[model samples]
Target: MELSFKGMTALVTGAAGGIGRATVGVLAGQGSRVWALDRVGLEQEGVEVLTGDLRGGVLLEEAIARAGRVDVAVLNAGICRPAELEQTTAANWDETIAVNLSAVFHHLQRLAGVMKKQRGGSIVITASTNSFDGEAGLIAYNASKAGLLGIVHTAANELGPYGVRVNAVCPGLIETPLTREAFDRPEVIQPYFAALPLGRGGQPEEVARAIAFLASDWASYVTGATLFVDGGQMAAKFGTWTEEKAEFAGGRWRLKPEP
Candidate 1:
């Protein structure tokens, strides 16, 4: 089936950055009237750009009010402060939740009001693989992402009858501005290559495509689902057994016949 957003109106948050910027491009290219929201401004053909902080919620509400109707809402603004559980301060936790989970809730609450009355819409959130797996020094980030699942499932069930679908895209090791510096370091990037079954990092457009599909009529029957755009990272938990067998030296299960 051809995926098209012809004549649709899509509001995308965090549009200045990696995944969000790509999503704005995808939606616009697909013929949607796009509103790109971020702290920084963006300029592109067929897209209306808005700048504001997601934490305050005023900008989001204003955008919705101004648009009058929203066909698709992509909640992609989030922050990650790497602090271990014990080291995680209250401020750290609050900021992460405010931008990631709470902002999503507020946006959806507003969008649902419009969509329910209009009787149809799609909402896609940019969750993360960290939603399922815990990483050291990312307590708040992981928790907030995990919380998005609850919002997705509950919102889906409540809005399903109204033809409003809510879903999330969980990205893993995507090449984005946020990850560029770390990805540039071989010490940081090599481990992921070994763990991911696809043996490579994903691009923003890859995740954006999934988000676009979920936000389109193509996923009409799909709801409360979390799609992983992780290059098989989530499915490659046991990959180390084969890819790094040399680490098992002196064990019965060596890479070659025991001598």
Candidate 2:
């Protein structure tokens, strides 16, 4: 289906990052008047860049005000500080919760008001597959992501009455700069991807497409829902690919060629 954002206005946070950059391109290419927000300055050809930290509510308000009217808002800014429960510091926890969860709440609150007045809009949050699974060494990241579901549910319910829809996209092992190290280590991904039915990691563009769908008219009836952009990683329990039946090559697992 064609996802068109012709003449619409969109606001995207974390626009300097992988998924954020891809989302900006998708929305803008589809005809949306896109406003890209990030802590660092962005130099995209057609996007109106808003440089500021998401933790501060001021930048969010500024973007909303400048946009004049927001038809779609992508709450995508986040940081991942990996540490096991025993090793996770209070400082790390606070920072993660602040950026990943608290900031999202504030953004949603402001966007809800705008959309409510307009009587319509879509909000797509960048949640993660870690939101559901207890991945090791990511106590704070996992907690923050899980907390987003609560926000999605609550926001969708309250905003529905005002003709606003809220949803989330849960990506798994997307190849962004944040994850470049992991993607570089074949030893790390071989075992991890073996369990994934798709036998590979995802790309930022893939996740962006999912975000676009949720933010577009194509998902007119979808709200308070989460679309997993994982490569079937969440579906397998005992693992899908095996050394005997598949080979780990070119950074991913692939089935053996048929004779």
Candidate 3:
């Protein structure tokens, strides 16, 4: 009924907002000495909170130094603003990749150094459902999240030898304060709900629990896996009679109801 991570040291990115804040609260409540790292304001009692962009320089260095050692590092920082493929300019794509992909790498590199010195740690990255399911307008978001799978896999293979485990959590539509307004919009959530098999989005804490599991001793042997927390979005089937293109007996295909 209770999960304990007492005395552990954790660095959580994107801690000023939604899922990150939820994770910080969950971990802190469970006894982990949490460093709530973010690029914006975050005030919490009994937590060594720091505000800074994880991209580069003094901010990251100072945070790591302050922590002394990190037993868990979560790269939960990412950005997504819906932009169509053709309409997605170079700047748009670059920003998404920078924050969602490049930022993860930056944090990983720094934290891995600290963890390796301490001889071990767990690294959880926040990927998204869009990584696997195609979202028409958010092309850059899709690519950035999908890239985390590769990063986790490669890191697991490389870091496993050092007792460091790397994994990713691909969250579905989570109902966070930031999404509350957008999802509350009839012009938005109405149509979105139709596609959600559960007919509702998930909460940030729901995803946070999964991250904790992966980062805890219970998952000591788990690594290089993408755990989807979507509301069956990845498995939802088209109403019926969807077409499938395949190389059958002689490189031909047919349109039929999938068995």
Best by TM-score: 2
Arranged by lDDT with the best first, the candidates are 2, 1, 3
Residues 28-147, candidate 1: write the lDDT tens digits: 999999988999888888788889897777888788878878999999988788898999999999999999999899888988999999999999999999999988999999999999
Superposed Cα deviation of residue 197, candidate 2 (Å): 0.6
Candidate 2 lDDT (Cα, 0 to 1): 0.94
Per-residue lDDT tens digits for candidate 3, residues 14-88, read 888889999998888888999888889788887887776767645667877888888988889888878889999
Error of 3 at 69 (Å): 0.6
Which candidate number has the best lDDT? 2
Candidate 3 versus the native: TM-score? 0.87
Per-candidate TM-score against the hidden true structure: 0.91, 0.98, 0.87
Residue-pair clash count for candidate 1 = 0
Off by over 4 Å in 1: 240-259
